[model samples]
Target: MAEILNLVGSKIRDYRKAKGLSQDQLAELCGFHFSYIGGVERGERNISLENLAKIAETLKVEPKVFFDFNHSFVQPPSDKKEAALQEVLTLLQAKELRHIQMTKKLLMEIFKTFPRQ
Candidate 1:
């Protein structure tokens, strides 16, 4: 049950970031408290189905996206590199245009440690 909560929380966080919404913004859209939204993202809250539906709608993703467990890429990252990369992606997706240069610099630093594909 805890694992499920964590997975659901991660999916919610990913979709929320992808849509460029802060927890406060998402909470506003779902008529929930910002702290509740933060708890949901942290896997500390067991969301009711009604609230889940509201979240799905607010994130512009189907509820099923949260339960799709086949992709290891979407699962909790198993290593530090994957975790760091995921965080970078989330930030890049969520932040405004003014952050692009900083994001690019971060990306360049990360990629410097790897060979070009």
Candidate 2:
């Protein structure tokens, strides 16, 4: 599906950026054109398995890594603020899950002090 392709492309872009490789550089490493790499990163190309394998090998990651989509990353925000909020929520979910219930209770009590909208 297009959505999965987009997700995979986005992850590839993220990893590529994190590894400090330019599209042209990645393309050279994978024996492809810079334009092709660009298209892949932008989700415009439905990458073939052979090419994907080459890319994975060039990137020093497993082929399966490209398809390892996490539920939290299923969708991305178009807005910067929403993206930041999502990242904060992800961190909180990972680090403060047990404290969430207490936080929710405190928020509910605080809300009671305010007039209904």
Candidate 3:
């Protein structure tokens, strides 16, 4: 049960960050206190399903997305580049289609600015 709480909390944190929202901002949108948001993200609170649904609605994600923990079992990255890539992929998870497309375009533009090796 604790593991499930932690997994759900971690997923909520990931989705929250992906939406470019601060804890204060998300809490405000969900009509919750910032400390409550922190507690939820830290797995210190066992969130109610109704509250969880409110959070999901605020984050523009489906509630079930938080429980899709299969990807959380990934092995540690072997190098810095791999670690960074993994972080990027994690941030991309559960993001809206338009936002993902915007991110891809931004990445492409940023990469073009890099000098040839």
Candidate 4:
């Protein structure tokens, strides 16, 4: 609903201001147009998933982070879940993770060369 979008926009503006990020600066970090950031903050434009993801990444947070009314991150995992997730992550082959990292780097570079609207 329009009210939800308005809330999201308000939250974005508040968080951005708290972090001392200008619309231009945040847009640059997300590789977006400054106008787009302004529109988003004003709830005047519909945001796309990709752009939302990019904004979240640039803000160094998860996408769900932006939607939360409190604007706070999920607390660090409890001991049990932390241990299990750590074990799982640790068991992932180093070489496979390295390959994934390399692929991500390559894709970022390739995308940077594309035109931005």
Candidate 5:
């Protein structure tokens, strides 16, 4: 139970950072106090489902995403190509949805124009 809380807290922190939002900013958006946000992130609070939903909505992610611990352990890239892919993923991780969609479209067009052998 404590471990689950910690995991959820860590996931929330990761998403919050990825979205480039500070604790205060996220708290403001979710109508929570900054201290509450900090507590949640630190696993010091047993967050309620209602509060969790609010945070999830504010973060623009589904609440279930926070519980997806199975894929949380990312292996380090083993090769140059994999490293490059990881770099690209990291770059896109912080982008807005529309920006990511635009990037995907651009990449698709470029690929169509230059087919791989």
Candidate 6:
């Protein structure tokens, strides 16, 4: 349905921003025109299978990632360092973030106290 496509569009735009990719960059990687990316993002155009494949490959995710429009953050597996880092980062308020910075500095200083032993 058109509404579904718009939801997909917004999700794609969110992922695109999170990945720090511009529409032009994504379009180039997918071998499409910049307008095509814009149209897709605007939900004014439906993408073809080939475009979907190219986009999936360039985005480093499966084609179905485009359709999995969950707004909830998908935590990485327990084995992934990034998930742990994300957890740590999310614990911070602005003041807490400042404390985190100072904690990191203290840890760095503590580590520097030891020589190779």
C-alpha TM-score for every candidate: 0.61, 0.60, 0.61, 0.56, 0.63, 0.60
Prediction RMSDs, each to the true structure: 12.7, 8.8, 11.1, 16.8, 11.0, 8.0
lDDT (tens digit, per residue) of candidate 4 on 1-117: 777777777767766776779999998888888798899988887888888888877766667756877433323344898877765454543448687688679879999999997
lDDT order of candidates, top first: 5, 3, 1, 2, 4, 6
1-117 per-residue lDDT for model 2 (tens digits):
888788888878876776779999999998898799889888899999999989888877777868877533324455899889787676567556668777678879999999999
Better of 1 and 3 by lDDT: 3
Kindly report which residue stretches of model 3 are placed more than 4 angstroms away from their true locations once superposed.
Answer: 72-117
**Candidate 5 lDDT over residue span 1-117, tens digit each:** 889889999999988887889999999999988799999988999999999999999978889988988656334456899989988987887799999999999999999989589
Candidate 2 TM-score to native: 0.60
For model 3, give the 10-residue run with minimal summed lDDT. Answer: 69-78
The most accurate candidate by TM-score is 5
Clashing pairs in 1: none
Q: Assess candidate 4 and give its TM-score to the true structure.
A: 0.56
Q: Judged by lDDT relative to the true structure, which candidate is superior, 1 or 6?
A: 1
For 5-116, candidate 3 gives per-residue lDDT tens digits of 8889999998888778899999999999878999998889999999999999998777998898767634445689999998998888769889999999999999999998
Clash count for candidate 5 is 0
Cα deviation at 7, candidate 5, in Å, is: 0.2
lDDT tens digits, residue span 39-93, model 1: 9888999999999999999877789888876543244455899999887776676
**Residue-wise lDDT of candidate 6 within 1-117, one digit each (tens)?**
787767667766766776679999998888888888888878888877788777778877677767865434353334668777766655543346679889789979999989968
Candidate 1: which stretches are off by over 4 Å? 72-117
Global lDDT of each candidate: 0.84, 0.80, 0.88, 0.74, 0.88, 0.73
Q: TM-score winner between 2 and 4, please give it.
A: 2
